[model samples]
Target: MKVVLQRVKSAEVQVDDVSVGQIAQGYLLLVGIQDADTVAEIDYLVRKIVNLRVFEDSSRKMNLNIKDVSGAILSVSQFTLYAQTKKGNRPNFMHAGKPEYAKEMYNLFNDKLREAGLLVECGIFGADMQVNLINDGPVTIIFDTDSNY
Candidate 1:
């Protein structure tokens, strides 16, 4: 499992000229699932995302988690995160999980986040989505379940 987290003043997802999900002030999560990913990985990623201290406190320090700030989450499925571009000019997506598996994990991930008491919004899985966001502080981070970074 992998995620690209961006602290955003606002974010939204549109499909076929229709807005499906949107958030005012929160995080936009671009999520990717691998073949080896399981519920455990999903659990870990959700915990980390919610508890991430990207929001600032009264002292202007990034010490508050999303929950502390009453922020929301916009989750979008992005299999391209697993794209392997080390070979030829074209990138290979062999590492990306199958569509069915990806969908399952994606839904589970969002459900878990909602269960944690955060208002969650999501893009249609497997749909071509256009995401818009005003990145707060331009703060972004890439996180992986398997890697220690």
Candidate 2:
């Protein structure tokens, strides 16, 4: 499992010129699932993302978690996070999880976040999506369950 978390003032996702999901003042999560990913990994990431202290506090310090600031989450499925580009000019997606399996994991991830009392929006699993966001502080963080970062 891998995720690119971008703290945003607002974010929205569109599919086929129709708005699908949107959020206000939250984290836009680009999620990727690999073959080895399981519920345990999803559980770990859900906890980390919700409790991540990336939001600013009254003292102008980045010390508040999303819930403390009443923030939401916009989660999107992005298998390209595992694109293998170390070989030839073309990128290989062999590292990404199978579509059906990945979709299941993606849905579970979003459900976990929502169960935690955080409003979670999501893009279609296999649809072509257009995402727009006002990145707050341009704060971005990446996490991968298979590696120590």
Q: Highest lDDT among the candidates is held by which one?
A: 2
- Per-prediction TM-score to the true structure, in the order listed: 0.98, 0.98
RMSD of each: 0.7, 0.6
CA RMSD (A), model 1:
0.7
Candidate 1 Cα outliers beyond 4 Å, as residue runs: none
Look at candidate 2 and give me any clashing residue pairs.
none
- Least accurate 10 contiguous residues by lDDT in model 2: 140-149
Model 2 regions lying over 4 Å from their true place? none
Give the per-residue lDDT digits (tens) of candidate 1, residues 1-149: 88999999999999998999999999999999987999988888888888899899999999999999999999999999998999898989899999998998899999999999999999999999999999999999999987988
The RMSD (Cα, Å) of candidate 2 is 0.6
Model 2 C-alpha lDDT per residue in residues 1-149, reported as the tens digit of each score? 99999999999999998989999999999999997899999999999998999988999999999999999999999999999999898989999999999999999999999999999999999999999999999899999998888
Residue-pair clash count for candidate 1: 0
Cα displacement (angstroms), candidate 1, residue 148, comes to 1.8
